[model samples]
Target: MSYNFKTIRPVMPAKDMINVILSKTQRKTPTVVHPGYDISRIRGFYMRKVKFTQETIHEKIDAILQDFPKLDDIHPFYADLINVLYDKDHYKLALGHVHACRNVIDNIAKDYCRLLKYGDSLYRCKMLKRAALGRMCTTLKKLTSSLNYLDEVRKHLSRMPAINPFERTLLVTGFPNVGKSSFVNNITNANLDVQPYPFTTQNLYVGHTDYNFVRWQVIDTPGVLDHSLSERNPIEMQAITALAHLKACIMFFLDISETCSYSIDQQIALFKDLKPLFKNKPLLLVMTKIDIKKFEQLDPIDQQKLQDVIQSENVFYSQLSNKSGEGIAQVKEKACGLLNEWRQNLKPEQLTGGNPNLLREESILQGVYIAQPKRVNQNRMPVIPQVIGKLNRPTLKDVQEQNGGAGVFSFPLQEHFLLENPDWKYDAVPEIMDGKNIGDFVDADILQRLEELEKEEEMMDQAEIEDPEEDAREEMLLNTRDQINKKREMIKEEHHMKMKQQVKLHRPNLEDAKEDFAKKGIDTTFLEQRAQKFAAKKVLQKQKRQQQSSDDSDDNDMDIEGNDRNQRKGRDALSRSRSRLREISRSRSRGNKKVLTAQEQAMERMSKKIQRRRRNEAKAGDGDTKIDCKMPKHLFTGKSGIGKQSRR
Candidate 1:
């Protein structure tokens, strides 16, 4: 439950904070801007500065806010202690102001950046940037008082001692100068200032000591005066806070000798006044400076008064003198023992922060369970030795150090052997004898046990041979299983063959079709007759097409020869009529004898037009060999850096 407040970062004044943030922004962002550059670029330049400034301011403020502990989130002891030293309201307000300033800075940056996008000129953007930063700085300046207060609190908190409120604690408190600090200095290494003046220990001091191998925290609080809670000073309130909140044993120190400027009656009255705060807590009435004045030396009335308080309060009473160190150990033991007993008696709900729901949760109760025997027996009790003490023999570590340290001294391993004969502890036996391991015969009854096992195996074999009915039944079941397996395999093979036939595409020949139809017991005569007619009809159509094609080819050859002669004659003539020239050109222009239909000719013309258009635009085709720009200006012209080799 204790927190290390020393790790909280130091808070800076508003002026220093502004200077640091501004300088950081200047260093991190671009420093130059020009009107000649693109307007977008100019706007971006100033926008970056404003945004960076805002972010730096937010980071600094946020760090301060997070570093300080929230009073409500900590233990009540520390929460009240902080409230006593620094007013709770002021602490919260200071942190709140810092938080609010961060939000304002963020808003300023957001608004200015939006306006910068519309900035028409570089000067306008620069002004908006300046305005944003100035507004943020002004907001921070307003927090000067809060910041200063936080800075002072941070310094004081860093010096405060870390006290764990949940641990076994012994809280020492009473009027000042009653040997409370003296008792702590004697028991622990607290080394507190023990002057003979009241209120010498002005703040809470913590020290640690161990009992039963468990660490215990001892806290020395400033003395509390017998007055109303409202009238108590900050110093006294610290002690009161510890007394009110911590689950520890309260050790009320009383100076019965009257050397601390408080009478027995007054000290007892103060104890009674603070008794309400000790409800359900372990209380110890420690009488210090007993060397000066023993309890029995007091007046009979004073003794009776002390006895009465002890009885009424139900508290433990003890006396100690720091000067002579009398009863100091006894006091520590009694306080620690009482605190431990109180902690043990606490309920499950009390241990889990008083949350009853947590008790029902399996995770919380995972380690807590009652282990009970199914049936209790008298012999189940654990055995305990009559005498338990350290052995007289030296340990291995002690013997090793005495000889020549670890490496030079080696302990005999055989000395620890538990044998029937002590003198035979160092006797050695051969690992193997006559090709057989000596360990195999180490047991004296090994041969007899092996003979018994062999006889048992022989009897088991004879018993199996005697069961004729069981053997016959097993044979019959195995034969039935074999028949069932064969039938399952045959069914699987047939299913696979059917699946393959369904997926394959096959055009069976006439012989194959005849054989397949015969297997299916269907008539094949009609199918054969229809197939003969189909073949005869196909032959007649093929012959007709061949005869037609031959006639057309013969006529085409005669026309081509006549056209060639005309073309030769026209070439020989010096000049020919336009009609004669046109006929010759048309005959020679026909490359294929088979003529295209009207629609086909139109489609060809459209395709040619499309090709021409593509050629004009220099479009690449699938087969065209294209080489990319080898020296693109943007990529190759500038210095090669990361991500500059490719435009993508």
Candidate 2:
């Protein structure tokens, strides 16, 4: 039996039986609870007993406007207050509780942090500020950020770290207020942000930690919005541009719970645009905040749904809570683990004597570096064929090592060619003249010279960056590039002319098709002329049909005017026949508004014939065969045709 009616459990009750038992306790008799105040008890009774006046509820609701202004229609907040006043437990105020709810959750979170710091006590009234249910509801409100933190912590615990200088990196990034700030604050340190608002950090801030003693840098860029590099609201393009040439892995943040909540497709599209920036670096899909999910809503972390988020095995799912440091370690470990994996997968950097490499001589730049090139035999490796343009390859110093030396080309041949050339000598050196020996230059002096060249090349390779004062130089380079492009075009034209001449020389009369078009003023070489001719031909044919129709009408009029008795009847019949013909023509013309002339039809036929002839000419072209046409020495050398035949 219980003396306190409010302390009765919801399940273990018969009110009549409890009333009878309470009546028997003339005086209070029971074991006392342990010391330290219980905050939930106070909050629970107040929640059930007290009725908030309209004035007080309105005051609290209006106070939230000062904190978060992104919300619209404060009526929802007012409605929630009314519901609390009237006891409507079913009303969900996800959008309404944005600002006010966070304060409550944070207060409760501080209690947890406090308890963790101090000893747990029943007498610690301040331990659970306001109430436990209030804490649960607030945490419920900020589910996205909370789950994201937890996920980060879990990932860090799962993956171990790699050695220093050999570690790879993953950069988690997104627009400002997308929970990136809270995410960094939760996982790394508890107090990185000075404020909880926009543009809090004016520049790029990098945080480094040695979890498992694996050195790694986590980049927390300043808040970014949905805009291009040059088309930003702030003058600070530091964060967006820093990512322009990154080598680390990327974790694109998507916070759909905010006012600027981007759709999944929009996030995926942004990923695609940013994906190329990383140049095939590993990408992780981080769906932030799992706590705030409403029961009827779809789970944001669902796999099939996330296929639309990022379509790759490189993606990872995480839920984080910055307030509690829920997934901070996991996120750090995941970032480090990815970096380490990439480091291992990175094509082993080539060993060159110029760089004072530990690898043996004759082995530098001598291994296979092809990517997924087909195998032809056991001995022959994938060949980057020595064509005119494809001859440029990564130098020993320029090539980054790739997956176990499968002969995969690590650097893009086009971008890397300007940086270093394997065939170009950095110093003045004698080449293998006609038939001279090549192994006579292996002294210590040559080795020193090579080492110096390697250091210079390494420095220059790293210098492929944006230069500010080179505007005019860049324009000059552009002009030079245009000139080179024109040269290529002229060369292409020369090739075309040569091919045509060779084909015509082999078989005459192929140019007749062009001549036919010229006679008609078609200027077949000019596509515009053909179109105009086709139009004119249609007009001419239409005019001819109209003249013929007028002439037929005149002949019928003459028969009707000069006629005997039978002739007049015949003229009348001819008039009737002409009228019927005119009616039929009108009906047919009405059926199809478009009308073409005879010459237009003929011109179309001619155009098709010309096309067929040109196609046949192309089929027979076979580019010009550059074969040796001279008679073979085995057949005609020192022998007359008659004598050779007689001998055979």
Candidate 3:
């Protein structure tokens, strides 16, 4: 259905199919499964082989079924075409056989695996697995004919044309040797055989050509002989199926020269018999091979024979000489024009314009910039919180106006200290002494000084405005900016000098510490020995602990020997009997392998005791754990002095 039939896989022979399964089984299945492994693990290994092989075979078969298009699902044109080429019943039967084989294989795998599950030995399981694989291979081998037939079908389908039944088409068909193939080759890009013999075009050959910027396909079907439906062969039925199913413009070619062995009367009779297929379709009666003879030059009786076809309503007539290449383009253009007009007339409502938009372009552009009214609820007013309503907050501009209006006035910043002491709402002025009438002295001259400053600024503003020269005003502005910068630089330099003086005043005097300890009558020659004495004490403690452990182990060994000597042969025999009883009881409780005999139990106990003694001896013989040296001799012993050996 996708028009890519070549992607179908080639069928495998029966022998090759079995070999493929066998080789895949060998490659995927593990070679070894030890008996000591859990029983479930062993069963799992064999089950994997059976499932893998079964799935592989199913995949191969299912792929073929899925790749081939279902006849019922495709277009009727293609469905009928396929039926004529390959019998529908036979095709379905072949597919059914392959599917049945797949089911057989699945059943075989399930039955044999069930048997293998309870197999008691490795040999039994392996034999059962072999039988399952053998049965699956045998079943597949029986589907040899079905696979071969499907393979052939795939090849034929791949070579078939990818035709669309719904597209605008021109069905070029007529009696044999009537120049149908010739006309198609001349009009479109199809490589149709132009032989002078009859039935040159056996299968349907499709060609494509563009008319009015729309693609029009031309299908050159095999020539249909004048016969009954049951008498026609598969080749002729191909054309009949197309004519019956394709909703296209029909072009019935006529070899007026009678070179195709069909008389003019015979061609006319065939047209009348198949006229029902041309009903409701745009029909064209093409007069082909005009180079050999003209229709007008024919006898009066022959012209009368074609009168019924040419005089019919909605039927067209054309004269074409494919050999001389005349009237071909005219015929193609006339047919395309009629097809376009007929389609338009079939759906008259489409010509009335189906677009639903009612607005004009100019109106849309004019209304695009108009502002619509904002949607709001008139039923209720917005609510304000109670806490917000209680507060008296001033706008920023109102606060700025109260404090000072730009550069005209400035407010003195007073520290509230509300967190430190709420009672002291006003900042404490350190400059005002106690019992000195603070407010009187602090603000007594403030108004007078402000008036004096205002007078100075007024005088400066009058000077700048009164000056007539622009250059003098510019020079004064530059001089003022330079003076301001110089004052800032001087203040910065004074601050830096003050910081340096502060650092020098806080510097410490370290000359007193330079006096040596010995100069103060202090003795310090024992410092080195004091440090080494601590390390030496730690080493001595570790050595004592090691010696104590060794002594304890020696005493334990002597005690063990004394006990061994005190025991008698009769007591040893009694102990051996008890050990055997213990072994038997442990075996029953644990559900393990055979229990040990009396002699074996005694030997096992002796070996364990000997091993424990040897372990203790090895531990006791180990060197001391004390620290040897902070600095080893090999590292600290430098190259020997130039003339004599130096002791470290």
Taking the candidates one at a time, how many backbone clashes does each contain? 0, 37, 0
Best by TM-score: 1
In terms of lDDT, model 2 sits at 0.49
Candidate 3, 478-503: lDDT as tens digits = 99999999999999999988775444
Ranking by TM-score: 1, 3, 2
> What's model 2's TM-score?
0.27
lDDT of 1 by residue, 1-648 (tens): 468998988888889988888888888888877789999999989988998888888788888988999988888788888898999999999899888888888998999999999999988988888889889889999999999999999999999999876666899999988988888888888899988889999999998888976677899999988888899999999999999998889999998899988899999989999998999999999999999999999999999999999998888999999999999999999999898678767765564454445444423434555588776755666675645335456789999999999899999899899999899988775667675676776898889999999999999898776578988999999999999999999999999887754566687889999997678566678779989999999999999899879866775667777777757876766356766777677875567674665665776899898799569757686466565777778866746678655210
TM-score for every candidate vs. truth? Answer: 0.55, 0.27, 0.53
Evaluated against the true structure, the overall lDDT of model 1 is 0.85
Residue 479 C-alpha lDDT in model 1: 100
- lDDT (CA) for every model shown? 0.85, 0.49, 0.78
Task: List the candidate 1 regions with Cα displacement exceeding 4 Å.
Answer: 348-648
RMSD of each predicted structure: 18.8, 41.8, 29.9
